[model samples]
Target: MKNALLIATACLLGLLSTTGASLPYPILPPLFVNGAPDSLTHFLGLPPKLLFALALMVNPIGLLLGTAVLGSLSDRYGRRPLLLVTAVGAAIGHVLTAWALASRSYPLFLVARFGTGLLEGHSAIVRAMLADRLQGPLRNHALSWLNGALHLGWLVGPLLAGFTIAWGLTIPFYIAAGALLLGAALVGFALERKPRAAGPSWWSVARERHAFNLLRHDGLRALFGVQLAYTCGVTAFYEFYPLWLVEVGHYDTRAIALVNVGMCGLMTCSALFAGRASRTEPMRRAAWLAACVALAIGSLGVGHLWVGLVGIMAFGLPHAFYNAVVQAWAADRFGGGHGQGAVMGLLSTTFCLANILMAAAGAVLTLVDTRLVLLTGAILTAWAANRMRAWGSGAMAGLPPAA
Candidate 1:
């Protein structure tokens, strides 16, 4: 019963948090490019495209720091308290974002997004919680549940934002804020209060025990490199496609949301399926999946919008399979010794770093051509696939020397 409750709460929190986080996705591109000029969108005479990149980059910057620190904090301090506080704090961040949108203040928007991203890392906390209580296959299953919930939220968030945006531009953020507060309340109710182990001072913990601490382990070094390269590809695809839609596909907010609906809906289904499916040769599977994603995305370079949309929608299944198998491999290999929180946090850190790198590079690339971003994603993922194939063959030629 306790396990059931925890999983349920985890799913709920995943849904709410992802929905809140994704609310601005369908909104931001149009707001920057096509929405009526305002102080926020037209800030300091910078091009809207550059400002949009800044908008996308800031939150993930905070997420990088927060995911690194917050996960380790839960390891020492306890999960329930930190999770609840961060949920509430993220809710506050959403309110500030809504205000920034209303007042047309780009600086305030950036600050609010950074703060929100910093506080909104409780999803990682919940993953650590799952890893803490569950072991072996059960842990993998629980992660699938969370993955499904998150992808469903991805679908729901854009739909809600797209459909209701005409009501008011800020309504989606307000709704997101409300949903987060409700998630906080649910976290307080469903999660049990666990006694924290006695540990060093909080500041000391923050200083010493970050997600990067896991890098000392030699076995994970290659894994880290592969994941980072792959995530660079993934993040590039994620951050740029909407811009692709805006500039090349000639899509507006609602159409982009609808397109995301197809992608995310399929992703939600695929993640659940991948979680339960048995598979062999995990590394090979990851390689194949990455290759498929690369091939599909490579079609974008064909310069036909409809062809690219087919590739985009086709992306979800293989990507979900890759995520499920790779994450399970990490937990199975590394979870027993290293703390799950630290392990998961490091994975998350890689993701954030990828987002940062891709977004910054994309800002420059968008200035050149949006297709350049998509092509870069294809190239990186293909390279990662080759590396993973080599890793599986024990060549380990170019990777961290297996040390």
Candidate 2:
């Protein structure tokens, strides 16, 4: 019963964290546009393009710093305390963001987003916690469920935002804040504390050779590269997909949200299926290659409305499978090590860096052609897929086969 409760709490944390992270996506572009009455560009007195990019940039920067700092801290202190602190801090950040939006204060809003990113390292901690508690197939299954919870949150957040955004642009932030507080309460009460002897400080962890040594292994390096490339592709696709819809399909906010719902829904189902599928490492690698091909095809097809919709769904479905498989692979490698937090932190940092670059690139690419940006993502993803074939075969030499 206690184990079940812990798993349930972790899943809930995943849901809340992802929902909070995704809520702003459907609403932010319109709010940051030039000459949109009472928008961030108008209030901040900045160019529309610059303000839009900065809005995307700040959050990921905060996330990179926070994950790099806090993931190691969770190892030194304890997961329970770190989880509680970050959750409450995130809630506060959300409240402040809502206030900033209400007052039309651009600087305050930037600060709020940065703070939120710093505190949102909870996802890494949650994964580390689950990895600590479960082993082998059980761990993979639990993580898959957590992934499902995340996509479910993504599905709900945009739908909720689409509905409530009609009421007020800032309304979604307030609702997200409430969910974070609730998540804090759940973590405070449900998660059992397991303290260890103090581990190395964040700086010490960085200086240590053990964490760095893992990268010397060819398979691990490839896995990390795959994650980076995948994130780059995903960030590019999502950052511009809404704009594409508006420009090419003549869709409204609600329609975009509906499209997101379908995509996320497919992603959720794919993750759930991955949890049950009896997949070997080679098979998983093959599927990842196939997914990259689908993403490329879908991205290239985005010029047509129905074709683009199908492409987005195709991109989403394989994404869930690849994420679960790679994460499980990483957890297998890092399990029972002092560097779990550090390694996860590095992974989070990589993801954040990818997002930061893609966001900036997407903004600039809009100047050229929107479809070209997605095609660029397709090319990157395809390259990563081809690399994985060599890396997967080489990495499997000594590692135990997937159960």
Per-residue lDDT for 74-189 in model 1, tens only? 88898899889989998999999999998899999999999998987776788888888987777888888788887788788888899999999888888999988998898888
1-403 in candidate 2: lDDT tens per residue? 2668878998898888878777777667655542365655665465665666677778887887777656667767778898999998988898888898888778898899899988986777887777777877888888888888888887787787888988887888888888888888888889766656766665775355323345666545655676677677777776667767766876666777898899889888887766654446643564464456446444544588778877877766777877677677677665556456666676777777777887788678766676776877777677667656545555445543433
lDDT of each: 0.84, 0.73
Which candidate number maximizes TM-score? 1
Please report, as a residue range, the 10-residue window in candidate 2 with the lowest summed lDDT: 205-214
> Model 1: runs farther than 4 Å from truth?
277-279, 397-403
Task: Return the clash pairs for model 2, or none.
Answer: none
The Cα error of candidate 2 at residue 53, in Å, is: 2.5
Provide the global lDDT of candidate 1 against the true structure: 0.84
Error of 1 at 7 (Å): 1.2
Q: Give the Cα error of residue 290 in candidate 2, in Å.
A: 6.0
TM-score of 1: 0.96
